[model samples]
Target chain A: MSGTESPAVAVRRGRPRDAARDRALLAATLAVLAESGYGGLTTAAVAARAGVSTATLYRRWSSKEALVLAASAAFAADLEQRPDTGTLEGDLRILLRDKAAGLTGESGRLMRALIGEAAHNVALAEALTAALIDPVRDRVAEAVRRAVARGEIAPLPDVDLVADLVIGPMVSRFLLTAHPSDTQDTQDARGTADRLLPFVLRAVGGQDASGDGGFA
Target chain B: MSGTESPAVAVRRGRPRDAARDRALLAATLAVLAESGYGGLTTAAVAARAGVSTATLYRRWSSKEALVLAASAAFAADLEQRPDTGTLEGDLRILLRDKAAGLTGESGRLMRALIGEAAHNVALAEALTAALIDPVRDRVAEAVRRAVARGEIAPLPDVDLVADLVIGPMVSRFLLTAHPSDTQDTQDARGTADRLLPFVLRAVGGQDASGDGGFA
Candidate 1:
């Protein structure tokens, strides 16, 4: 997801880092992010929660921002598990469901807190988007691309629009509306896709672009 | 704009409100919003900035929140001005350009602040979305709808997706990106649209959805 791979991140050879401790620190960081927000999260509290020395915490992450980024990276890795339902629509249905589930979890709260951070902290926001939003988006786009290749559906009118259509309203439903996380997710995703289908069909105008079956 | 009108708006009997004073007050309100954020804006400062009295401001808007809503209303009104460029792609180009321009202005900054407010303040966010985002979206949707009616585009796969595709990246660009204002708007909007065109065209699935037109 780092658009540019700047080679392997080489750390100076030293005593082996504690992988378990690192994981614990990330959990504490995420907990703090949800409870206190980025501004309020304290390194001492994170260290206390992770059961590591404050110096150790600082040694691992230079600042609270770095700590948050580390926490976010861990969340990003966990969030990577998308449901592969085979069909583009099927895979999306499952993937979006999983995403909505994640949104209301610790990750969702961290994401909300991180969004607030974006207003003032450039690097943090960029890290959050790159580490979080873009990777999943690419996967969705690839699934749609495959659908087109298989003639399962028409080519998209505008794939970017299609992706946005797929991604946008789910966000709007969550961020803008007061829809409960679990209760309204199904309707939100379906409704958004239903709305997007017509536009997608139009953007792919060609012999194969015409509707093949009754739209779901 | 009122998908469903509020019951709270009291009966009104007015000769004519001062157009000049109202305009001045709105302008002052926007200034206050930008300087101190939505939370920092106040009736007193808005009045003083407009060279009016707090009583005069209260006569028009009951509270700070109400005043902000009124300010947002003015921006929303401008958002409804439809651009009929005879084709869907062409109209989108204009709408997206204006959306970029709108974001470049005070309204955009104010919007970011208010959307942040929405995250914390439920009622205000609902009002902002209803008063602002939804209306503009409906108009744009209508424009896309008209394009479909004219055979200039194919059927909308999901109208909501069409809207999202049209607005999502723009929203992502504005809210997520760290850029100051819409400096890279033209390139961003055009580039995003260009990339998504293939998928979007396929989604539309039209004979002539292979677009060959301009928004103008």
Candidate 2:
């Protein structure tokens, strides 16, 4: 319910899949994704890049979509899906920082391709919706709900939109602008989350959800 | 220099170019953009749709890129590009509302294609940059700067990023999700703009830029 990664049961009684080769395959996905881009990703290229056979790759994933989906899911391992520091502000800052760290080379580029390609490919869109996007939405909503229950936010206006506003800039950066080494984007996301927290707290008005300014 | 649309120099002479036909050509461009999206858009299609010859269409627009750019320019006719409402809030609201109004049909599709294609299309991107994107960015930046001069915001941290955060959601929405209606999309954009303005103002630190519980 909390951490990311889809369920994939290992084959029931085969030669116990090679964990090392699996890592290479995932690494190969990122490699091919970075080297060529979405248009250039292919099973043969991925297998070759990973130094594994096509049959080995096929055993794990039936299609390129499935392979990319699994690899993208693996990328989430680097992300802390919902780290709760007991206070929203602290949790958010850490969350943002971790995401900033995750913005290294291939991961960001792969994310861009996934998002951009989703517009045209219905299957990828659906896969993305269930696997990545919705999970994020649900997680943000959960934090808001916790805030509401604890009487932090006023609980009046739509929580979903509030969550979008909180996280939307991050998505914007992920899609539109080139990644910045400057802390402006980081500070922006942090500040936006903190400022909006008060309004959301007021909206979901209560005694103040722990009254700990999430930013500070 | 101050507007999204730069006035082209008069070619001076030659039958004034059939007013009715010009109107029809632009209308046809919109229809084609709406129906075919970016990749499918063509001058040939526009010519056929408008009942104009290939020669006539080519005479006015040297290529497909030229036609799309011209049609994009045509879309800017109704916008007053950052009207001086004497207040930052008022100017922003108008700008946001005008952008919202653009979410429907061919204009929406064309704008999406323009940006998406900009990543790959060099000449089209340059033409669009001059004809469309830069002007809007300049006008919005100017409006924010006025807010700064008037002590409406603190002082912009990063002008371009501020521009991105301000307008980013609209672009994201246009490209990312399929909203049900233009009216709803516009309202969502206005709300996002209002919510984000305070943080932007505070970050910029202007006296008049108090957020004042705007997100509600």
Candidate 3:
């Protein structure tokens, strides 16, 4: 197979490609997206930033949307994990804190750019749903299921809507509202999550383990 | 004074610039923004589309940001009116339905584009908060006050947080989630508002006037 393989195929297959290179390329893609946004980003720019040839980029991903989708997916994958912290509020605090921490600097910028671009690009929109929205939804559903099973909450009528309710305020604060400074953003995120917990518990018909007596 | 007036000054002062002309120009700005996104919108293009001179546009608004701010404020103004429908659920339903209806075609596209642009532009971000976010917040606050006065809900600890909780899901659905067809979008909007009412009432400690028994 190596004897007649094309140079591009040989480079891809024969080279002992490490995970670091993939990480570098994806990071470069995210950086470019943050700096230039989706419309301004180019595969060439990403390749140049990553110190790789365009052929290397093409070998890994088919198009700009694919490259961005991969970057977004990797970023999202890091942010979502089902947490069982003994209580629903504890679980939510951990998850939301981690999510807020992750949604800073490059990751936040990449998300904003992708969301902006997705509005006009059908392929990007579908890719975003798969890469970003769906995973978060799954994670929230699992968390909700655990809470329900533990008798913390009644069965939710719509887990997806619950996910939206859980995530929406943060999204609104970060994306739709004015951009806060990084320090303020982090502080605000934590505070918002704390303030939001009771409402979320009530909304889900869950026991408020915080002992605040529900929405008092 | 009339004889010595500069041509520009005279044009500004003497021309019968009716509300219709202002509406036409703003409408033109929104149309261009919808079609081309914010990055692609130009004052020249708006003027051309509105069949007016660039000077006419410049005379009305100092810059592109000002022009867009005016257009966005006008658009938002039309969407936000405090509804007193006797119950919190009725008020929210009317508000959300009207908002969803307005967020179609040119308005939706313009919002997406503005959101995309505001990510990078500080002025646009500030303008967006003022034009879009503030009015909605005020309206939500008023509605919450009415609900409290009616003994429909407890006094919310944080009205702003309540506003975020109320609006976040819809914002997430329309802006961050995948786009549905227009018909499906309207139907989904209505369904979401319906489904969300119970949770919202529960969250706010409001009596569930819908008789759904609060998350059953």
Candidate 4:
């Protein structure tokens, strides 16, 4: 996913960093991003918001693109905290529900803008695909692997394809009608989980249809 | 989806419109849209592009939103012309393949931009959902109906939901990696159909696992 990976990254060693300052800057960056968009984001604005000097901001990240990517990386790391309900069905249900919650309100707007902007901006696009898409996809793969280990699903030729199958419907519908107030707004994450789980369950070859095997 | 619907529209009688002129205008609107984005589109530009007067443009569409909606309607109408390969599987393979073709190159850029812009612009979002989203969804529903009529599939509990299920994976994957030059660019529609068709067929309960029924 990181198509623009530099040789320096592989060989670079970490320097002692201020954890609290980094958190503050990232938080300020996310706030600005949520309010404006990627196009409107500036390192100066982020520094002002964080009460840090521009030089300090530049010390950690090179540019607005670099800062946004770091914030996205932090965001993605949070998304990797998956629910373990002892069954694939339950785990997926909770996972999808959590995803739904994230895709609403301000956070949803930020995500939509980031994904949309990725189409035009190559650097941001590659970074997002690397930090956001790949890790979360791997997390889903790990969940499926657990399901396979537990005999909840078959030993399929392609586990990643199955992950896409499970996530596609909810996300597709979500992206189409994610507005705050619309007549055909079907952004209800809980309800989406309810309607879509059966098909996913069946697709994975899960034996328990009764919602007992982690569905509830 | 048509949030702009009014009782007047239902009661009003149609004024005769020139079919060829309407086509030209819509074609021009799409051309300009593909070249530029929604933010860059203007009525004067569309009129000039179509070789029609600004008066003529306004005579048909009162505003830029109206013109874009009309063009979207034209796009949706073209999507409705799905190939009939004598079986649901064949029809869907062709259908998805055709969709994939549309999503590549210039047309793909237009589509991606439209979807992304819809998140910020409510009017465009509503018009697109009404003109583009609903009509194409109806087309999928029609395919399902035809399959049912041929006894190739069962009567679905909810045809629209099933349509979303069929389309979600392809569109989701398409939207994520839509750029022309990206390392993770998996925009091959034929390959997408090959991987995705089995799931769609299984979901709809098609008889022929072999591509002979309509897939080829």
Query: lDDT tens string, model 2, B88-107?
Result: 76766666556555643445
Candidate 4 is scored at a TM of 0.78
lDDT tens digits by residue: candidate 3, A47-94: 999998887788778888889888888877766676678777777666
Instruction: Count clashing residue pairs per candidate.
Output: 54, 18, 0, 3
lDDT against true structure, model 2: 0.57
Candidate 3 lDDT for residue A74:
82
TM-score of chain B of each: 0.77, 0.75, 0.86, 0.75
B1-216: candidate 1 lDDT, tens digit per residue: 122433233223222345578888998988888777776777899999999888777766888988888887886786677878786656666666665555554556676677656555567866877776677678678877887789765554456555555555566656655554424455565566555544433444422244351110
DockQ of 4: 0.26
Candidate 1 has a TM-score of 0.71
TM-scores, one per candidate: 0.71, 0.68, 0.88, 0.78
Residues B91-203 of candidate 3: C-alpha lDDT, one tens digit per residue: 77676665555554456667778877887777888888887777777777888889889987777776787777767777777776566323245666677777777777777
For residue B115, model 4's alpha carbon misses the true position, in angstroms, by 1.7
Off by over 4 Å in 4: A1-17, A53-55, A82-86, A181-187, A211-216, B1-18, B42-45, B52-62, B82-91, B143-159, B181-187, B204-208, B211-216
Query: In candidate 1, what are the lDDT values of residues A29-140, reduced to their tens digit?
Result: 9888788777678999999988878877776688888888878988888868655556665656555555555555455566667766665456886787788777767876
Ranking by lDDT: 3, 4, 1, 2
lDDT of predicted model 1: 0.63
All candidates: DockQ: 0.28, 0.18, 0.56, 0.26
Model 3: clashing residue pairs? none
| CA displacement after TM-score superposition, residue A171 of candidate 3 (Å) | 0.9
Give me the candidate number with maximum DockQ. 3
Better of 1 and 2 by TM-score: 1
